[model samples]
Target: MLDQALKNQLAAYLQRVTQPFELVASLDDSQTSREMQELLETIAGLSAHITLRTDGQDARRPSFALQRPGSDHQLRFAGLPLGHEFTSLVLALLWTGGHPPKVEPELIEQIQALDGDFAFEVYMSLSCHNCPDVVQALSLMAILNPKVKTTVIEGGAFKAEVEAREVMAVPMVFLNGEVFGSGRMLLEEIVAKLDTGSAAREAAKLDEKAPYDMLVVGGGPAGAAAAVYAARKGIRTGVAAERMGGQTNDTMAIENYISVLETDGPKFAAAIEAQVRHYGVDVMNLQQATALIPAESEGGLVQVKLANGATLKARSVVLSTGARWRNVNVPGEQEYKNKGVAYCPHCDGPLFKGKRVAVIGGGNSGVEAAIDLAGIVAHVTLIEFADQLKADAVLVAKLKSLPNVTIHVNAQTTEITGADGKVNGIKFKDRVSGDEHLVPLEGVFVQIGLVPNTEWLKGTVELSRFGEIVVDAKGHTNVPGVFAAGDCTTVPYKQIVIAAGEGAKAALSAFDHLIRLPAAA
Candidate 1:
């Protein structure tokens, strides 16, 4: 099941196993089961401390469990964990075999201290870019806490269960048979959810922090760059974000980044975060900024309030909170989110396999989603508000070549209609004809665009009519000591490289402003 190069790599990594472990597999006479057995045997042959057993009685065939004898540490994989989940399998092996995880010491202790029985099941797809993080996080929790158990389920392998649960998205997490969350989630975020009191404890710690010379309000490429640049100036720098990686965590392939050739969004985000941390920036994740209180005087401190009720003060602030997927405001869209409406085609496309779906928009994102879905879904109806597709010529041509894709220009999505709490169809209007039509489908993918996350800064800083932070060439907002950068600003081209460069410029401009400030009292 694995190539020679992959086997050699696995062999090298297996050397880190410090203790004995067993790969207990449940199998039947099926092609997938045979392939899974071959893969398990290949893995077992690499490490002296590993053993393979085929006596597992799990209800799911072609499934396997990794267990350490004489211990309660155990985790299961209910399908061939290849593709994005391959890394998850490797980590589970190492962690179960007594290899230490890379998490912080405090978090490890927190995981071990959790009381009560917790069972987690994460349903994910092989093509999903965000599935690995959730899978790995749950696996780590299961390995660390004796009371916690986790099972990673491949949605494609269990289509009946996915349909019964109405799981239309990837990385849909369930706790004790109830929905926990959907989409990408980090280890810290999961722990925070379970611990409950962790938020208050975290808020207390954040409230005690001293004012920083430069505080960055985000954790995307722009915020990471700003934090790194500010810290390089020998000033105290801090970053507060809802999540460390921002929207990049949900992104898939990124081939346009300069020099790096190619890399996915998660890896790029991690590299930038490591770069920021290397400069000693105090990175605070899972903190949402709710309000911005400007400084009273030129040299005074600016206070940013968080959703947790804790506030952070800084000498200068760089707002690079970035943007999020723009939702279609039509009726039933909100009522049926995750029921049939999805924003990520890569993550949710497999859930709609053999079913009809609609792609709302004709831009690059919309066209790309349609092309990707054409191979999985039965049919794709592309609706556009413009007269022509805004995608590049090559993409448009490729989309046009797809037999199952239908395009409608000058079309506006009116509503997403659903039945029995699940999406059933979509309504659209032909602008020229002034007529409305409905396309019968099981899912609707909205790829309209992005909206800046600058709602908190409203009335405090100058903003464009589109709600973007208005900044000058130097990345300075109208308010002194307040700078903005990245997609959240009035910058043209919302690319990662451009955001990083703007972040650096904003930091330098803040530093320049700092040097000319009046002496503090």
Candidate 2:
């Protein structure tokens, strides 16, 4: 064990660095040699990172643990840190340094200004190298900001801990006892996050022990569609969501939708939600689910938990979280969201029906939306950042058929200019001529692409590079008892009707598994 003088010096160093620094000893085994025990205790006493404890700690607390700089950036490992993972440690050091590269300037400002304590817990599997980057990024934030502390836990070594938390995937991040965003994060983004208020806290608290036959994790058109179907199946289904409508809430006016002559977006979302409620499905509003755990052998049941303390044990699980719009990753894109900004033409195009609107990207979705909007809007500008339109030949031909739609080859949107509460025009640069021009317009529809919300699911389930969940037509994950459907899953189309149909398929598949479980047991 280290000498008492060294422990006192370490403690003084930690206290001088920051305030409200707390310690949490992460002990895996109690049985050890006396020398080892003494060493651990001595280390614990000297640790500015963790507090030594005699009583065991509850697993849930780590996710919310607050950190104060000098005392908070704990990088302790029981064994020698080596192998490819050693690279992560070096990166972590770089993160702790001020002004890490690739970090957004705004994010740095937010992190530097943080005063409240926050903890970040990330679950990682052995196979996930992507997770290490996130861990490193978060660790950097902890070191830079005295108020933030981060922890990286190996999923396999923490089985009981993970089970208690109901973690369904690797590389999952929980902030302040609730889930923050998952997948990849830029250093600048992490710094920026320090300024934003916690979404999990404003939502419901986790229950840890709720009961339901099935739990659906989304509230979008796909998730709502799934919930209605699951309720009809006579299962006690619960739906948890941050917002009820998902991307469907942002549509302008869906014209091509079958059976609907011309309908607005908000109305469509409301109608779907109404239908789900008619069946008495438990819909938890302002709630976000963080993880999903499969049912274990020997009477174990699937468990769904949320950022709030609320949890539900289920015979089946349906993931219909749907997709989020993709950003250009360019400058000024974020500041323009909902200003001159838009994702769905059917949702926002009619607002500019008689005016001008510029559509970015040259995919089938972009071409289709442009073609449709050309009929109702005055001037339709289609901008393809690529050299050629990569859409199907038939779609390209159809778009060319529209006289009102002007297709600009090799054009990219650089910035959006607006006045007051609405969009007025956009700035674009010609890829060929290097000429930049501002096109006056009332709307701008970004059809670049959709990103599925499955980044946290790597190694936990099969996912395409596009981040869509891979499932059989029946909506089953590669693993048993877990099912997925809608836009978030690997389906060909991303239509509301298709999602509704897929929701039904997933429910039936889950029901089949539950029915057979009794016989098998």
TM-score of 1: 0.99
Give a tens-digit lDDT track for model 2, residues 384-495: 8999998999999999988888888788788877765456777889998999988888777788888887765677778987889999878999867788989998889788
The C-alpha stretches of model 1 lying farther than 4 A from their native spots are none
Residue pairs clashing, model 1: none
| Candidate 2 weakest ten by summed lDDT | 76-85
The total number of steric clashes, by the backbone 3 Å criterion, in model 2 comes to 22
**Looking at candidate 2, what is the lDDT of residue 188?**
42
TM-score for each of the candidates: 0.99, 0.52
TM-score of 2: 0.52
Q: Candidate 1 on 316-427: residue-level lDDT in tens?
A: 9999999999998999899999898999999999899999999998889999999999999999999999999999999999999999999999998999999899999999
Tell me model 1's lDDT, rounded to 2 decimals: 0.93
